[model samples]
Target chain A: MPPDAPAHLSEEQIISLVAYLAGGAGGDLAVGIGDDCAVLGGDQTGLVVTTDLLVQGSHFDLELMSPADVGHRSMAANLSDLAAMGARPAYGFLSLGMPARPTAAFVSELVGSMVAQGRAHGLKLAGGDTVKAPQVVINLCLLGAMGNLAPVLRSGGRLGDAVCVTGLLGGSGAGLAWLQAGRDPAEAAAAEAVAAHCRPTPRVAAGRALAESGRVHAMMDLSDGLAADLPRLARASGLGAAVEAEAVPISPAALAVAPALGGDALGWALGGGEDFELLFTCDPGEVPLLAQVVAEAAEGLTVTQVGRLTQGPGVTLIKQGEEEPITYKGFDHFQEPAP
Target chain B: MPPDAPAHLSEEQIISLVAYLAGGAGGDLAVGIGDDCAVLGGDQTGLVVTTDLLVQGSHFDLELMSPADVGHRSMAANLSDLAAMGARPAYGFLSLGMPARPTAAFVSELVGSMVAQGRAHGLKLAGGDTVKAPQVVINLCLLGAMGNLAPVLRSGGRLGDAVCVTGLLGGSGAGLAWLQAGRDPAEAAAAEAVAAHCRPTPRVAAGRALAESGRVHAMMDLSDGLAADLPRLARASGLGAAVEAEAVPISPAALAVAPALGGDALGWALGGGEDFELLFTCDPGEVPLLAQVVAEAAEGLTVTQVGRLTQGPGVTLIKQGEEEPITYKGFDHFQEPAP
Candidate 1:
């Protein structure tokens, strides 16, 4: 085992391997690896827990994001995992790594924002740890209660299940692109795009409705866009996925800002990350009713079908009345995962 | 507020303020701040959770600690918090910030040790997330079951309660000192000190027994030694404390190595942190029976009474028949507390 031996696996594969090696779901662990949150206590009625960490440079740009925005987004990223499982936010433990010379005001604002964000969804901050580090780091472990509803897992999808998405997509991706280019924030659509990137809402109600409807077979939050996230869902369910190019729900902000930014809306819709929307698979016969259920549950936020789960070895895109193989590059923490 | 304005608050005060502002124990939160672990669901039943984060440069010396040692200590530290509350380990979520270009072997050893350590206490790794970081950062969130036993809190001590401690003290602190002094590990008393520093056994059974005896008032693991941790316990209980210097349990290893290292075993025993023993307050009437119960429960370990909780404004150390008010300058993350 040379120290420089390059790992040949992808990030997803590496995570799966880690999960597999770490031991999968067992007694009292209803679902473990390859799920939005680990289901503990029971299958349908127990606790769901998720943990996430965000670094300063890798996760956000300080030039554009205020301390409050950083805290808010960190909370949003973790809560979305709970939303994917339709778990009610309960309590959170936040561990912070502050810079060595951190000012008291900065530390106070950063923590205050996280507490406020947790309060928005009825989650309380119970306890935490703070240590000095080179840069600001936050790790949040959230526990949610799963009362009387089966946590919709990524592995439950069946072949031919209609693939649906909540709200629009790519605004967050387009927003980051716009901001990274140092574009004017006062310009038309810039504020919307920036806000989308900084504070995307988690689709909690929509996910809960889908789970309660008993029509959805699988569900996951679209943090990594469809390109990266769809394959995960399909792979977890032991199926494949297909996306209709024209049917993809591109955000109005992305559509409006893409031309000025010299980007492609459809590409962003397909591959852009940080959308914070819900992606799901449901019985095709109940698509209309499920859409209605989601809209009614989430205050007129419509969930539209983009494609279907299929019996295949990989994901494909249907465009111009022809299906073509697609492997859209997406953000992965690892350049190449360990085998 | 100016960003650079000096904030006159200590780290502990800052933490307490945050907890107070965030919200104290309410609803299902049995105990919020000032406790080893946050008790959730009910007072005597349900769960307890604790979170801790360890950074490479600040918390550990990579030169002295292998990846496996790092993993082991990280798990041990979090589990000690559970022991203080008399909770049985259940599951854990480990979030990692892996350095870019990490060796596969290093990653394997690090993760494997953590999983193995969790299994020692019947805790399983449920799920986790990883992002690239400049240095290795490990954050573990552990949950344990209360199982119809009341969680011992730092705020439970009463006036005139006898203060007690489990096992020996100062071995870990002395071990760290010896290693930092560049002493040979093969020398006399060095191996024991190094092992004590690397993998201190948590007093899980002792804590459980003390809780079961129903005579223990307040309890906490001695992570920060008597000088630092005792004040915290006293403040939490809204009382003062007195420690008899002669009665402080000094580890044989610390005593043996102190002369050669030109250090005072008494000072190390008082100010030295990371002892991982349980410091508790109990009813004086049950001292004899409590000691027997602890000995029986924890496999012949002795629990010795050292002092008493008092009705006063501060802690005092009684040395050689002289009572002196002592702050002792224990380990505080902040240089000075903020006002």
Candidate 2:
């Protein structure tokens, strides 16, 4: 336990504590803890399973988002986990905790949005359980099938692997910041950020293409910003990473809001979360092949090489002529606001 | 929608609404909405999935049960769903919502109890997500596998199938009543009820035996009493049922507490929920073989024949010489209190 491991531990600390308590001795599971999804029965066709929770106030504020947006975002979060593993989305089970005496329209809208998203991703909502609570709680469990290949894992990167990210970063974080500032959503620059924050498109096609290329060695979705998540990938693979500050892609929306918040655009690009983009590692020689695979997928996505895995441990950043260690901190639920 | 459907719909009504919204047109699902677990594929080895939720005040009262008991019961609820499908328990994912600043001890206790139960039933706690909320909310998703046989579903019963229940009923409900009455747990009868309510066992071995014997046609866990759940099984199979009032298995603990609550033991036995016992349908001619199979499981569990499926549209209760249609009411979360 860390010095701050008390009643109000960070989300990462609590998850680590649980991982320790639940031991990594899964009998038939290929990958258990420290991965995006648990791999069950590692045959030609492996099953990858993941679960996510979206709570009222903590995950979404009803005042800011509609029920449909909440439903869609919750589905996207879980589907992104499957996409990280390069699995074909198959089945979904939802357990919803609703407020007492919720209206029929409320229930219908929530379920309809979830079903529509499921159909878009080829996932069928097969079963679910519901209960009345003080607020809305959406817990979705998704299952995906790995067809004729091993599901990609976070711990598969090598020392010489090139670190890359799919799509731009900082859009969702910028959107959240704009919303929190009580700004007009109709503002030209804020529109993109708000839309990205409300409805993130999971990089399913990009992830599948990367996984099928047989070049990508390790992969994971960026739910918790590149600065916080890249170190996790490094630690999992027992290596280190050196990210070039200039190479990190910053969205135009984030750039527009950076001056108003008195923060740099690059900071948001590195630390802002909920991007739902893929951060992966591959052999330096396979960059062109990986790009070709993404082109064939017709998703019009850009894969940017941001860093390289090193033989050392932990993550470092090269900004201008200075080199500094990157700290592991992001959008933790229990983390205190940084001044 | 029913005439009574409105803002304050009952739990069953809400579930029906969700099912309608989700739709039952599962392309590759062997069993979908109206079954204990959703069967993923119809091959020799099929995956069965189920999800359940335990809200703080709605599902369990902290004053009545310990954290460990709450954790144990939540796992039991999902395991029972897998048991109903005659599937081998495989993997589990738990998503927990905790109070904003919960004690470390509280989190540890809850997770420890869940992990212990998972190990006992050969289930591996693979992955999960946690969020902060107003109260503790537990949502568990379980996966099971049926080997070398098709998963038994609630729609498999025919008109001539006999309705049977494994183990006794009404114990958990009686236990809950005892606790709510502020009774002492030290009392012998109350102790049994309290134990049953706190740690109801899922009949996995019995379920496997019945499925292996190829005698059981339809099955589901009695989460919502015989009067309510039997109709569900019947409706799913496009059949009706006739239950004998005298044949319903009432526990001694329930009988002890019934008089104090101004109700009969049979009433508790008929209307109780959270029993976690298997209510299944089998061919009348195969009842003897099913009993023998249960005996071989060696838990000394009794398989009681309480009713039979009929070629009609609804359930009928045969009491003395009179017959009455059973009402579709049980422990609905949004239901009004009985006067």
Candidate 3:
């Protein structure tokens, strides 16, 4: 850090700085920062908007991921935010910055992947802006609608609510590890892990089903791993949570990569990020209903109850008959080493 | 350009490539790539969204513009797109990429400028993403509402509509020239021109009023100069335009810098970009109403009738009682010399 630079300010500090400067989104903006998506207009006819950026060196590497995968992941990151709000994806705006004039073929491949991913979730590429830059930066903004259901927020969790997560965890993290290790791409397990990291799917239908169930209290996507993101949901709801370590689902691919990486599969499942899966809170009695909703919406997808909300503030992990408080720390852009 | 670099493709070619690869925003997206803002939902209860990117080296220089100015201009660029669609500004999301760890004070200054500018137009800063990058990049996505009127798209102009522009032109272009020449910043004229270039205001009120009048047929903002942007509007509407060169409004500040820069004021007004003013079209009979609406909404701002739509395709400049077909060329990112 330079003499004039701030002392390794955390992501939370930067967010607070922005909040302090911006005050609050009064008037038309119903929900501002701290939520899965910014809510605009009223509940009757509202819009949920979210924006995410994918930097070349920080978020991805050109050597590891194809341009098509980059495009897909960029859109998926933003669409997942809308999914967390249970909003139906509607329109998208992509702003791309390239280091130099890329070939027409490259541009087509990148944009085609975006369009294809968007079409899967009923999203349309409405418009975007392009410019030359020092590196490739893709910023995607997605707009979604509440449809027949009201938008779900991260601040609705209550004490004793069941904390549940969709799909398995740590696959993306293990996949990233495998790719970084330069493992053979021809291996079936390695290929699966890499695909999980490169093209993680957003749980749009599952989110919509959960929202329509009227049982889900709080919801958000697991982008920064369970250890980091669950605390956000807990803090937003003015509560704490106790997650059962044994109940956390570690994918087969993650388990396979754990021994070679010299780390436990459970640790990766706890702290690994970029899963793009939904983590929600619902009434303890509604867990079965939530599972049914997910089963009906997406075949083969499982919703597991891994924890329960508590009245106290802060998250704790119950592992091996012991309780350990979890710290709130995600992938900080400034603090963490560049990928 | 490198042999594989597409030979420095023009901006138009890039746009066409994007259009071809993405196809069109069919189904829910009412208006797509060719318009100023993408329209979602129906005309009555629709949403307008637009995104713009500001690169540190390409769009602004740190030495020339303050952080506040960069923030203000970033919001202004997106707001101007909403204005072009005659929509009321609603919410905004900013995605910022910084080269290194920024100071708290610097972050506050940049975000404060964005909040202040957004507040002026009844817009609010909802949320955003931040990350470290090789250079500063600000990407803003603005969402707006039509508010009792249909969105006035760039393709609404007919064969006989009158072409008009709000405020003066070339001030920003001339300001860039003056700043590049290292003129004394203390001089009133020089300062005013620089301000125009650095902090050009979007004509939100004028745009809203025009849409309310139901007289303006088509609209867009002049960000790429008349010589370039007018052709876009013409091509979108499938009509030609005959612009009266003498009628185009050139700012006094532009005229003052022209001689020093060895350029004609009219040429700068026509070809120079970044004059964030409204360029709209209306029926000849409704021109008076359009002017009245702008006068009532924004005092001291002038709306000048500089051209009329023709039955053919392409833009022609009428000067000295003769018609000169205008070429379709503007600031192409890949082709233009780096600033």
Candidate 4:
């Protein structure tokens, strides 16, 4: 679930649920689901892994996607997590369940795109399992190497670190809005927004560059909207956050589409998740250098400071000098409308 | 898809389809989908990983299984794959899609069981993704360490190598037979078979032991039964295999229920998959020593030599001095009646 799953079974809940299982495991396991990717400790300390599932009619609408787009988006979701950890992508395993038997061509295109995505991201589509189900389900696991590199974890942020996000937000949400409204991208002004929602690019290069910069304190990808995801980063770091409402970078595409769809761009940027951009915290003085490094590493990318990790215990929003507790919750992507 | 899917889409096909993408990738990739697990190469050469998917009504029956059993069985499937490679289990990532909202107890039991199963197998349930779908879907990806352990590849067998398997076959299939026939184990004489079907064990300890013995040449688990799985091992080794029909070990439970079900125990042992037995080849002279090692390593486990790798081009079965090509196919666990 992404944001408003009702069952906000967040990483915190999952950890609490599995607390009984974590009591000393021969010292092999380190972190669980609280991080962007699981960090293997002790003997496997330098390895990080993550898995994400996409269900047809739940995470994606097959009607609006080409097989390639589905593959790309699914791959991107996992890749983004690995990126957040500053891990170098290595191997990928995919398991798929297709309820309907399309032509061999359809299967080929679908799988080919996955292979292409893996190759594009330096990930090898190494092994996978295929089964039958009631709908199209894709499960992807990526194993990455953090060897010889420092992992930027979500818990490392300092109370006074500047919270930053790379790239604009709300575009993906607006694209989804356009889609849900039955406006085809080809025939709608929200085509850019739809593309943003559909073809998310994992910030592998920028993440790696940021990690290498050694200035980043904590990092994660904004998949569940900035409003909900920022609090998670703050909580993970054992701190709170204060965001300037005006500092939230709304996407141009979202701005253009919101008026047409009668949607609020600010709300979408704050609460309409699915923007696969890197969110990090760093020393205030290093912000400019961090932005420059990411922009140079990955073309056309920008880093914006939206807030600061605060000493307080709850996230607050600064609107015209008024501080208000954040109340925006995101829908669980797993339970959400199709991307 | 498993053995008898009209569309086998075997690893060979999967590899062939991606050959274009595998041509040159900065020398990072070493292998693809043709083995029990993908062999990571280059900087991460000491690792092996595998993934498997289980779907409701396709791979398992909820009515016949407790959530714990489902979790264990799913874990066993992937563990068996890692075991085949002589890999040490490290981390596991799970992806689940639940169609209906079961009670909170159901969810806890399901996840807790997965955690328990991972703990029992020295695996850490590190991360996972959850979603809502029209039917239950489970995908597990396990990453293992081959460090300091020589991985037993399916292609390592030499001509005249003894073909062997761990434990009995056909019991799981018989168990499935009972379940599909609506015979509850509480009042059934095939209770052991039902137990076998519901709680198939992966031969991890024995597999690792075999790899340590350094005598076993090629290896794989019989997830798709002996008849179908043996040929895969043979093909991978660039050789053929010949099995003695009378030597194929049939489980006592399978034997006891075959007559009751009017089933041919031999046929089930050969083709009715889901046995989860490790099948391997070794130097004929090392059979006794290899068997003893595994027996010592994994109590109550036994390895038996059924035949030998041959120099021919295909698999053959000899019954009473007559040789015949094997034609008994297995239903893909991903396609057939639930296990």
Candidate 5:
């Protein structure tokens, strides 16, 4: 673990680091970490790729984050994008930056976590680069397959489509609020919220099911809260939407903690980021079947109809007796945080 | 661009940024950028990938660097890794951490320059993530193909082979020194040296030739200066080497600027980092064709037989009739800069 000792990097250490991180699923990876470029099994067929970067200080704080969580979240963020496009992940290319004096154990833990998550997602860590830097930065690019299926884009929604979301939201928002308030929650609540923040479960199965149904029009993962992201899908599809306030699904756990946190459960469900849930729209005729399919495919996750796409250009929230335009604002990269 | 700008970006600006960074000489990339995931036109293939992060104040100074140079260098650094492995570049995924309110023209110029340089090297900018941060940080991940060629690894060399280096060195070190001293060089010399510092040329063709020949036993790129990197390659290959100091290819421009910069030109060539030239070793029999093949393959680049891989396990420097043990010291990430 000493900074100067390279001998600590035994064969086991190397294997443990790369076993899950790089290599081909079909055993066609020519070279892995010991060499420079990984030689993959080749045939010019299909490649689906997406890249994302997560900064240490910006995305996650090292002081409060688990190395495994960092690794999991890094891969999860990119995989969520792939899921939204209904792609089956096959391989990944990662580039990492860390301080030179960092413990090999730290690096190993991160890589080990990546390997575990990558395998779970049916992806092989094919190759990546490492360098010493001021911050621990991760740039992960996933290569996946869209076999026989056309990718679903955000521009496919049409008028009369039912806007839907898979699973409950606001858990991540509650967790962030807990952390920000500098007050710790009880064991079960804290664990649930923290896990929501740390390891997001991307709705890959629901996305795939939607893509296969031939009824669902548009789909995207909710990384930036639904209130902000819905408008993006709407704009892309050239349609507006109307959502009943009561229809938005808020988790019981989120509701239980919202009052204590001095934040609204509805607000988090509407605008919480990093939930990694799927927000989609489907034809009204296929609603029942699609909902059933999403429920079954998503391991009991709820598929709730939160809104309906209309032939217009803005989102509106319809409450008990009044309707108001839903401002499309969520997490802004440069905006000051709300007090 | 303002942070609150509309989500819909101008087609011209997007085109200017993305279109120019496409096209490569090797591999079948299925989807290149315009879509969600770039589909490499291949199936179940092994892939080699790497990423690097360049931070402002840590890597370079914005006051002294041009946007184009920043774009070029950030990408060039990652390309150099692929070059060291003799991999043909297919595409790159970029991740930028920019300060909010950055000049749109600056982003455009940086992206444009990256696109232009990518084309020159037969590399395409696939897609990437962008976010706001306090300082500018560029993270680039490259995906390359090695085909069926044997990847020249750092662990394959045997003793008694001729140690070779392609192209001149130490110009970047001298340039940095001159910049630190704040002493201006003659116009041409200043331009050349600074260019060498900012825009390193990765020896891709030479790397491919070295791999294709099946003669070179070991190889690596000189990014951390020869003094530091040669030892790394030797350590990886389980061998030692002896360098004839006079045999190193010194840049005339570097030599002209060294005295004014308060450093030795030879020292820069031996210890200056970021040259991105290839250093390798081959058997005595292969030496006959090494120069010819290198010239034909690398064109304007020069390859020199600088030293010999020895039976021992350490590096030795031989100058004139005198010999001394080489320290293998250069830019140590852990150590503070020379006082």
Candidate 6:
């Protein structure tokens, strides 16, 4: 049978399902989502193109999500892809499907949030489409520039390069647990989790800074959790990696909230999704300078050296002086396992 | 409540909804709509973006349509938009939501038909997303280039210009009637009507020809049938039009089949929809030259001067020896009186 929704979910509820499934607009877009079409500004190195699809019941929960939050998330997802390629976003295209008669205000809120976010990041809203469907589906396309330099690819990480990440991780998974467990954590913690999920700040500045440093070997964003994404990066680079489990930074609030959900903060940090942080590999000698420059350039973002690339072809996770082989698996739309 | 569907309709039967919406992969699209994201092949003019949405039971009917035809028609609908603006079909991005496990092959055929049409016009299938939904929905974003020339706006037509059209009209409306009657005409006529419905060819080359000829004043594709669309062009261009009913070329086959279908051939020719033909205006002196060149360039296509632009506003129809206003209205998704 076709998926059945409530006879009448408020327009806001429907908007919440599709809006933040991708982040809203940014400064790069000239037109954004509300117009008949999005116009992209001209730039050097042509336009960087990328798209992603988010599915309801797979990528988000309408019951626990807000329309504004969904709007923010949709743009953020596309932005993260731009950040990974070391491209500065200029505009985006959004295509959404949901129930008919969704509130105009709800759609406006979603578009407004996207525009606000685009302005914050110097991205622009270019164009997109909207239609009625059973469940919510979102497709986001971002146009960016290669800037004055080349993009950092997953295949660029080299042996002996220091692997690192910007900012904390696991907060989103921990937050999700809190929501799922029926426990109302402190308002601050709840806010942090929701922020992580809804407004993941793509490391555009950090990525640009790292790309300019000329010392970084490769780069990517941490979205499908580290354990799943890191190995892909390593494999693409034709190398293996040894990660120090303890070196991975976890959100303090996530740590505090983990016990109540019967999960480990480390697991959340290593495997949590929706953490739109940068994970890059640089020369070990460049770590100190890299940290200082990245910190200054990215504001509150914290750069941490967490691992080292090796000659072999597998991931090794070090914990309490013991070594365990780490398997990499992230979110897959048609995959059987969520991890 | 949502619209009802015929019983015994399988999930695949429903997913045929978005089967045809092809996005324009403008001049610089590297990729679009079937992959991770649409890669823009950025150009000097940047990107001219446009999007449109089609919903099941709203824009089309599954009971009266084949999946492949639905798919082809939907894409043709959006391609018509790009043609209206004289944009080169470059790349397409699609976002579709439908009941899952729909025959993959059928989906492939629908998409393949799109790819075939795009290939015929030098476009690429970039990227898009698919998900499960009760009602099938299609969202198409077509990216094309403005070339070095500014886009020919809908409001560019002027007085005293000759209004011309490429190809005949009303075949799609006739095709719809045949489908409703549960009868498929002869293979030849069926092919013509089906082509009108399934793969209405967007007049990209013809539009570009008009735009580049330096003779055309304004242009738009006939989508909502000539009766409704002519006024839109006239309104946009701040001019009036006098369409000659006898001059409006009607297909001989459409005329032959009209009596049998208990319909007027003139009505279908004037008010039918989905003829993706270019309706352009040019100086009266340029009409002869344009007709010759467009005919030669768009081989197998006929270009005819069917009307004349007037100083005042609105549209008037002139029939043989009797020049009077014809109150001809075409299809409107929202304006259609409820059944």
Shift in Å, residue B298, candidate 1: 2.0
Question: Candidate 6, residue A231: CA error in Å?
Answer: 3.1
Q: Which scores better on TM-score, 5 or 6?
A: 5
The window of 10 residues in a row where model 4 chain A has the poorest summed lDDT is A1-10
| Reference-based lDDT, residue A315, model 5 | 90
Clashing pairs in 1: B8-B337, B8-B338, B8-B339, B9-B337, B9-B338, B9-B339, B10-B337, B10-B338
Return the TM-score for each candidate structure. Answer: 0.95, 0.94, 0.95, 0.93, 0.81, 0.79
For model 3, the superposed segments whose C-alpha errors exceed 4 Å read: A1-8, B1-9, B42-44
Please estimate how well model 6 matches the true structure, expressed as its whole-model Cα lDDT. Answer: 0.66
Residue by residue across B195-310, what tens digits does model 4's lDDT show?
88877888888888888888889999998889999998998899999999999999998998988889888888898888899999988999999989989988969888999999
Query: Any runs in candidate 5 off by more than 4 Å, and if so which?
Result: A1-45, A62-64, A98-100, A103-112, A126-136, A187-190, A212-215, A335-339, B1-46, B212-215, B334-339
In candidate 2, list every pair of residues with a backbone clash.
none
The ten-residue window of minimal lDDT in model 5 chain A covers A30-39
Local accuracy of candidate 1 as per-residue lDDT tens digits, B73-106:
8888888899899888888998888766566667
Evaluated against the true structure, the overall lDDT of model 2 is 0.83
lDDT of 2 by residue, B184-235 (tens): 8778757888888998898888887788878788999899888889999999
Clashes of 1: 8
lDDT of 5 by residue, A1-339 (tens): 222323323322322222222221333332222211122223423455677777776677766667888888888877887788777777666666665455545655576677667767776665454444567877787776767776676878999899998888888887777766776644565667777877778777777777787777888788888888888788778999888889988866567677777788888888878888888888877778888988888788788899899987789888885788887585545343213
Model 3 agreement with the true structure over B1-339: per-residue lDDT tens digits: 123436445566666666665666666667777688888764215678888888889888888778988888888878899999989987788888886667776677688898899989978788888888777889998888886678998888899889999999988888888877777655775676778888889999989998888888889999989988888888889998999999999988898777777867787789878888999998898887788889899886889999998986889999998999887468777666668
lDDT (10s digit) by residue, model 5, range B126-190: 55666656667777777777778756777677888888888999887777777767656446657
Write one digit per residue (lDDT tens) for candidate 6, span A200-238.
Answer: 777878887887787778787887888987887898799
Provide the overall lDDT of each model, using Cα atoms, as 2-decimal numbers.
Answer: 0.82, 0.83, 0.83, 0.81, 0.69, 0.66
Shares of reference contacts reproduced by the candidates, in order, are 0.46, 0.71, 0.62, 0.44, 0.21, 0.13
Q: A75-97 in candidate 4: lDDT tens per residue?
A: 88889999999988888888877
Output the better candidate (1/5) by lDDT. Answer: 1
